[model samples]
Target: MPEVKNEHIKAILAIVPEKPGCYQYFDEKGTIIYVGKAKNLKRRVHSYFNKEQDSNKTKVLVKQIRDIKYIVVDTEEDALLLENNLIKQYRPRYNVLLKDDKTYPCIVIKNEYFPRVFQTRNIIKDGSKYYGPFSSVFMAKTMLQMLRELFPLRTCKLPLTPESIANGNYKVCLEYHIKRCLGPCQGLQTREDYDKNIRIIKEILKGNIAQVSNYLYEEMQQLASNLKFEEAQKIKEKYDIIENYRGKSTIVNHSLTNIDVFSFDETDSSAYINYLHVNNGSIVQGYTFEYKKRLDEAKEELLGLAITEMRTRFNSLAREVIVPFLPDVDMSSTVTFTIPLKGDKRKLLDLSKQNVKQYKLDQLKQAEKLNPEQRTTRVLTTMQHDLQLHALPVHIECFDNSNIQGTNPVASCVVFKMAKPSKKDYRHFHIKTVVGPDDFASMNEVVYRRYRRLLDEEEPLPQLIVIDGGKGQLNAAVDALRSLDLIGKIAIIGIAKRLEELYYPDDPIPLVLDKNSETLKVIQRLRDEAHRFGITFHRSLRSKKQVLSELDSIKGIGEKTKVALLSHFKSVKRIREADQEEIWKVVGVAKGNLVIAGLKQASDKIKESKEK
Candidate 1:
């Protein structure tokens, strides 16, 4: 790499392309410092080396540029699109990054004879039906709970076989005890009954609750007329669940059907936009925006940009968009843009605006909560100056590994968004295809898994990846990213515990924060979170293994019998403490004898081992 200073500006300009594309700015050691897209690559690339016209930002960027790299695209629009992709992939320093990177959970129905409802963040075409891109796991779980209560669906994971169903090999799960499942595992309900309930679940998921309720009412009446009183009562119970949900649905105004409501606010130069997604006359999803720079244009322009971006990214589109202010763009004939006053639309719009207002107030409260001389904020501010970051470090992810003497090795990646912990985005890996406690290999496994998903989904990558060790771990992460073709797209730093040091790629020496520095504290928090997540995951894996190992040695205890016992007692320790009667209750006296022998052997071994 050739250094590009005032003298090399002319030489750099000579090789610049006059086409639309993205460019990379690198330092002397060929480490990328920033990445950006441009309408005219030549002009954009040349601007960096222009000595006469330099602001503080430009000067800092120029000082770091020893080499430049460019990728040519056919059109400026393509360049813009590619730029967003690369910025999201590399998370280069100069790009305007979106702080929100957490994957939203969704309800999925696997395409199977007995379709199971489960939660997932990634949407794959593995023959399954997906219902949402819900913003929160809690919301998705709540919806699933409501569905389970209203419908007699199968929640068992056991494979459905004619023999297993008839012989009662599959035991009803706790969900049946709680009346949330129909216990199809026991073959108590006919296939027709299960299919009928599935139809109702599909209707509810498709926003056809009204139609399903009407159909259920007629069915209930028919059952009563036929003198099937028990069946009628069951139908009546389902109707009550529907009716309860209906009362909550009243909060959504049906008068303004198929509308989107948006609200925008700003605090401390940061702007936020909240979007309320209305479909079939109900608000199904709400999103909040957090951006570094405040909008210089009118509110309408910001709203238009948001709407256009949302439509481009998400599959949901509304017939009308209700905004706090009018949008700057021309509305399509099928779409109406309105500012409602005196109707249900007004109420809906007001509801979105109130959320924005509350969020702005909350931001103020958060700002006030921090000490005026807060160390973390000060360190981040200093880092921004030192490294010339385009924005503050709002979303940071830290990686760490945990293992026991090269066994049960695992790694964890934990995220912190907006200076607050995002527990839902935490990920754990079992160090598959890796052996020993080699920190580098373990870190590599975790990094590859984390970013490979991001690249595949074309989702925005994290703003920063902090390793919990020194340069070795940092280099391992960098190598993993490069393998995924994502190197130079994200900021990488390592926090070494031995000296509380921070190491950046290409920096000859590690940067040590003050012992009590606020920034150092924040890094510590992130490192601690990763450690905690890894340890928790390791403990769960160990407990599961311990129980399985104990059960494996028991005579006449096949996989099914072991599963039955563990499912009933949850742990080997609990099963051992259970008397013969309790053990018989779990499987039967015939199997209980094997469990008793297993317990005695395990206990005797423990005593002998302790004596040794």
Candidate 2:
């Protein structure tokens, strides 16, 4: 960390106000070094000079600062928009600059008479109608192709003036012969007919294909009522084509007008935002980009700047913007900022967030393809942040208790290493000294037993321990840790099955993790595995007791032979599956004969009893 030695820096910092606004940092020769938005200008701008920075980049940025400038806004959102505007104007060295962001494909209906409809990547100032900056080029192309199939339009470069066509100077091309185009070149197609086709194409391009389909459907019904069967059939085909195109679109609503959706993610050094431009309920364009921060930037600030740049780049006039946060921007009066709690808008925001995160993950996966350890390291790092854990929980364990009807109670512990299950390390425990299916006691005994043995044998312990229950089971495990003098040495949590909420020690409010977060997924997996292991052990015990009860009535089959039979065959069902020779090998001839006869008499008596 370094300090700004210039006298101009101190005078500027002294007057910075506690207001929401955009701030700029300038270096030697009055070049803007960074642009930022802050809720409180004084606290945000002066913090750079007051505190020691851990990021070397931040330290360097602060040392180079010569003067500060700020423009106050009405709200944080205003600051966001202003900061972005200045960043674009100055392209400050310390600001995050997005490179290689996509400009999505759009359907352009040319302004010329007998206009051509096609897909384009550029938006021109020409008097043409543009629809979509489609989320996918494939989707845009599909719509265009479907339109061409439904209505054969001209793709020619001919100047088909009415006088020239009336003079009969132009000839019909191969397209007209193949029925793929109307022969407007030679006035064979009327201007009225060509313009009608162009109007329908406009509707389809504007994501209003459903309206066209419904209208055609009504027309088909009217024609059919008049007994014009061929006319009805033709209308039906056009209706079906429009309906199919509408069905394939990812549009969520037909009522929604032009809007922009923004979602963002931040790593230590960079921020990524996904932008979706929605027009009349369909996503016209979707783009995601990563911005590498030359200075430490907040997630909100980065997202705000990104939104401004994206909207400006696309020439967007969208008044309503959907975002995860109310950016520090000055659009309070002129534009609407919607932070959707729930609905189609929230879903759209979530979709954008997923896109940005996946885009970032794809970049990482490409860089770390050959080395799997990099992925684990990243996951562990994420878990550490999400859980607020003291250390990365690379080695974690979970315990679960299973019991039914207060009999054959059992517990099991499952371990995970580097976020993957360690099956061989899983252990099942018989509930000892605990009566009447006390889950708390069962959990306590297992935790005490498992960790005590580990300490006695000097086995490596897990960084985190998960209990598959609510607060009671969690506290029981905590008690065991305390008794072992390892309370703070290991981190412990409980997962309540009802809401999947995480319970920590002495904390009143359970930590609510995002459902999509890797930390929650890993903890849930561990809890499920422990339950599976415990239930399997409990079922085995119940089956053993059932077999013992039925076979104990046999007088001649001694306890030694009972053990031998179970040990040899593993279960009573397998013992019953054996033939006389199979039993003979295990118990010797005389005892095997006695055992078979005794089992046969018991079976007969049970059948007779049931029949009676």
Candidate 3:
């Protein structure tokens, strides 16, 4: 145990109970700054002061604590529940903030004599039942639309008490005339029939459409037995509508009922939880919410917090909760936590995982769209982590060697700053030291030349260097960096074309990154850009060499005379076909005579070789 410097905290620790409950930490100003829960309150609270806190934030939190308060509970489950309530009551600055604050629409069954079903955002405590707190208004409205089509319920707000209806206080409205309502307001529809439809509406909202279908089927059969074919057909239509809707909404086997599924995803600063409520094998509710992490909370703790919040918010009474892993909360004997491995429950878990992943991706995309630099920083950070670099590779350079048939060997260096191409810094190199199509030697020469000049000129060196080759070429480049005493100064990697494998210096085994990862994509782009640049420069050199080769053999016709003739004619063959007078016009008479004679002799030599 560490030394306790604060007498107030030491006194509190001496008498604190070891029971299950929530504890509140208060600053000198008597305001609660943090709230936490634990099974053994004494040990958990003492842990803050007994050790050197690893996180700077935790250290700061401990330094400001002036008082301690707690509420005792019977079990860990009660502790979790009480902690959630207190956190909500007093949103302490150090607790993770639930980022979802939007009030989603819900289908409300208002409390009245003739209860009305409608979509609302406000909740009243007057015995009214709210079904959803749905994630989308469109989903709630779609349910309302289907209910209105299936049953002729009243849409108008009327005081349909027994006294008002008995006194004939209201009249039929346009909805009643159009057959969209049964005119309950005018006392034309019996209370039993109206309430019966409302009961069925509740069943549908609870995701029990099959039970309603069975009831309607039996009613239709009974009506037909009494020789009422028209009424029977109407009931059959209602049954068909429900059956169709159920067919469209059912997601899994019907036996998996009254279950809650939660999948977790997260990043460094935020966590996402996707919740799904399944009833009668159909999803009744699906939502994904985010939490802004205030401390280094584990996935288990954050997931437990989310599960508690979601179940309480939606009033879920599910006995079975499907999770990807066991959360850090005790559910007691009331609820069973299931980590499904296969079957229908597993499908529900997978669906939740998919939703959570997509939600995280959508959030990242939205944040990046708002601030483009965030995306760049995220990509570079990912690269640094994946490549095990000591610092962020803000400036990166990639090199590639290009050649064909041992002709015009060249290398290219493409620069990337902050994960974007810096075209002005792009450079091409001629293979000066290496002869023929020796890629390894060409890489060594260019890599040495590129950095040696940078060191000589005192220019900035790149944080990373990427070579486009396997181990052999990578070793050559590493030797060059070693020669310049730059092995430890800059990070270097080589990419193999066959497998897209990345290799670090002095390591034989390659690092294989995911094909879809952004780090791999950026490295691939740099390699491809260097290859394209080198190939273009190599081709240009080849074309120029072919044109200047034949002219170099003619000595009497000097360089100036050859340039003048070729500049006018555009090619050696064109100059050969031109008359001596045309050549004389481009050059002087002496040079023209000498150039015509040299061309004639070269043409005769080609003819003699072909004849032989």
Error of 2 at 60 (Å): 54
Which is the leading candidate under TM-score? 3
lDDT at position 389, candidate 1: 57
Give RMSD to native, each candidate: 30.1, 17.1, 17.2
Candidate 3 per-residue lDDT over residues 232-349, each given as its tens digit: 9999988888987742221433357799999999999999999988764545556688999999999999999999999999999999999999999988677899999975587678
Find the 10 residues in a row with the least total lDDT in model 3.
246-255
Can you list the residue pairs that collide in candidate 1? 90-489, 90-490, 91-489, 375-518, 376-518, 376-519
Q: lDDT tens string, model 2, 473-580?
A: 999999989999998899999999999999999998999899998889989999988988989888988876787865677677789999999899987667766898
Off by over 4 Å in 2: 1-359, 548-586, 593-612
Per candidate, the number of residue pairs that clash is 6, 15, 0
Runs in model 3 deviating more than 4 A are 1-250, 298-301, 308-315, 326-336, 551-570, 579-598, 608-612
Per-residue accuracy of model 1 over 476-507 as CA lDDT, tens digit each:
99999889887666888999988888998778
Give candidate 1 regions above 4 Å deviation. 1-383, 553-579, 597-612
TM-score of 1: 0.37
